[model samples]
Target: MTKPDNPNKTRFGFETRMIHAGAAPEPVTGARQTPIYQNTSYVFHDADHAASLFNLQSFGFIYSRLANPTVAVLEERLASLENGRGATCCASGHAAQILTFFAFMEPGDEFVASNKLYGGSLTQFGKTFKKFDWHAHLVDTDDLAAVRAAITPKCKALFVESLANPGGVVSDLEPLAEIAHQAGLVFIVDNTLATPYLCQPFDWGADLIVHSTTKFLSGNGTSMGGAVIDSGTFDWGQNDKFGGLTAPEPAYHGLTFYETFGDLAFTTLSHMVGLRDLGATMAPMNAFQTLLGIETLSLRMERHCANAQDVAEFLAGHELVAWVSYAGLESDPYHGRAQKYLGGRAGSVFTFGVNGVTGGYEMGMRVVESCELFSHLANVGDARSLILHPASTIHRQLTDEQRDTAGAGPDVVRLSIGLETLDDLLADLDQALHRAAAEGDKAAE
Candidate 1:
């Protein structure tokens, strides 16, 4: 296959790049859309070519389990968008996290991470990772002093979410990156909430970026996929701590990744070893759907941000609302950090608390259930508005103290604003609020 011209030479802006980067007319039929290569294996030129491909001396797809043409296009596009050297696709965001750990961590090793992260991630780190004998120290990532203090000699990486989920807290990536570098550790960021459209973590000094493409990248609530993009900036050769990449490998015939692949060491090793062993590779069909969704990412994100601002403003003045926690609002505690990092667009998700009369959590649940325009669902980043009462649903797994730490209190409701008309969304909220109030009043009486 012929390589496309350099994306940098085109001087394309983000929207144009989203639609065109890493995409070209189909070689087979001149088709405009990206065609999914559904075959399980590719043919070799001959026995010598097959031998070379299997030995990793030459680049060629041997099996869909290792790589697929459809998935490769998506990976290249995402890498270009994120300004990373390369990327690896996975079945889900959790799978991407596991692959990252498998590549860099070992038994008895620890990593320092932010306290404010998605609840699912918190559980994964605090619980699931223990099975591997790896540990995590959760610290306030915003406080550089605390982060520095938490980093032990055993720490191999610094993990943070660009914009934390549910809580909407934004980490100071530049400072965090500096800390990681000074400590001789890799820096990993979960960019699922912010998306590349809002913030590219690599620009702020992250070494490895992870995303759940099932969300904003796939824009319309279709397909479950994830990605890990290597910035190709981290010097594995400089650090003796990361022996996984710098040391000789047994699986690849004593080959050292840093010596062989240089900047692409992390990404290549992630695919060649992590994916091969873990079996978390993404399907070609899912990658195709995500690619289609990403093409319109810039446009969808604009609408989502605008709608969220409208809803946040409306909620702030409502008598039924006790508090609103949207970073777009000046009243929010994280407003300053959000302004500094979020490019003036405080994403589409925020949490608001309803004033409890006598019904308490029931009143909040009623408000969520009564919304006609917003679907009550666990997912976000849909074209349609979505609402969730976490205390009774997503955060139910946490204890009261844990729920508070996760920012999912009983009266709080999380909203993912959609492309629906602002007026219609307001009307739905108005009706829901009234219904909730009436139910609360009845309970009080």
Candidate 2:
């Protein structure tokens, strides 16, 4: 059967491509929507055809463990959006990170990472990876000298978040990517917070981009998914350090990925070997939901950023607020970096400290609990506002010093601004703040 050509020919904008790309009218049924291929296996022409599929000589789905048609469309769409050679979807963002590392790093290898990161990522690198004999050196990535000093001979990658969680620090990907290349290390960027709509890591020299689609990519809170996009720009053949790509694969007929697949080796291996062996494949239904959310990603992000800016400004001057740390604020230390990298929109998530006039941690919790419009949840990047006290929740396992570094303190509250009206959000916050303060005063009296 001849493959149908892509429907839209013109180089449409991101939003346009989101709804049109990877979607074509079904040739067999003439259906307008991309139908879900829910079956676990596809019928082969014969035994020889099945063998060719197993050998990676042909592109056809033999098993859902390796690939699914419904999932493939989403992967292709994400790869196009990211300007990457290809993408591999997984169960969650953490699964994508683990699978990506497993594809490149051998036991006893190390990677350098920024100290400021999502609490889950920090825990994964600092604790979980160690169990596999893979080590991570945490360093202050903002200081070039410090980054250079922390690299060891065994270091294989330099990892950073495009826009860090909680702290809202925007990484200078260009400089960092250059540093990684100079050091003969792969540059891995988590584009979860910024999403591809606001920033494409590959455009700034990133070799690999990872996303927790559960956040902004999904837009709504319906599904949990993740993806890893390979820019195919990194020359794995140039260095002997990465033998996984350059060396012969003992599992698949001694295939040398770099020689056989070239630019697509990383993503191909991620799907064929990483997800195949690890069993971290994303569900076809979830991928479909993610693709649905991605269709309006650009539109939702604009509103999210605008609403967040208004909320940030209001919190910055409020008497009940002790401090506001939003990159959109001119007073923020990360303002310059955010402006340079975040395309003038400082994102929807920011952290602030409620004045202890409400007492300490307990009062802060009350403020979060009292909020009428904002849901108290752990996740971010939802269309609805989310509130969380990370110190008592996500970062509770960390020491005080560690908490400070991760931007989660007893008085600190994190907000994931949604598309709600600015007036409604502010009013809800105001009522919550007053109630928390009154409770604190009663306790003191």
Scored by Cα lDDT, where does model 2 land?
Answer: 0.88
The TM-score leader among the candidates is 2
Expressed as tens digits, the lDDT of each residue in 386-440 for candidate 1 is: 9999889877867787778777878889999999999999999989999988888
Q: Which ten residues in a row have the lowest lDDT in candidate 2?
A: 1-10
- Stretches of candidate 1 exceeding 4 Å from the true structure: 1-10
lDDT of every model, 2 decimals: 0.87, 0.88
Reference-based TM-score of each model: 0.96, 0.96
Q: On residues 2-91, what C-alpha lDDT tens digit does candidate 2 reach at each position? A: 112322123777887788777888789998878888878899999999989888889889888788888888888888887777899999
How many residue pairs in model 1 have overlapping backbones? Answer: 0
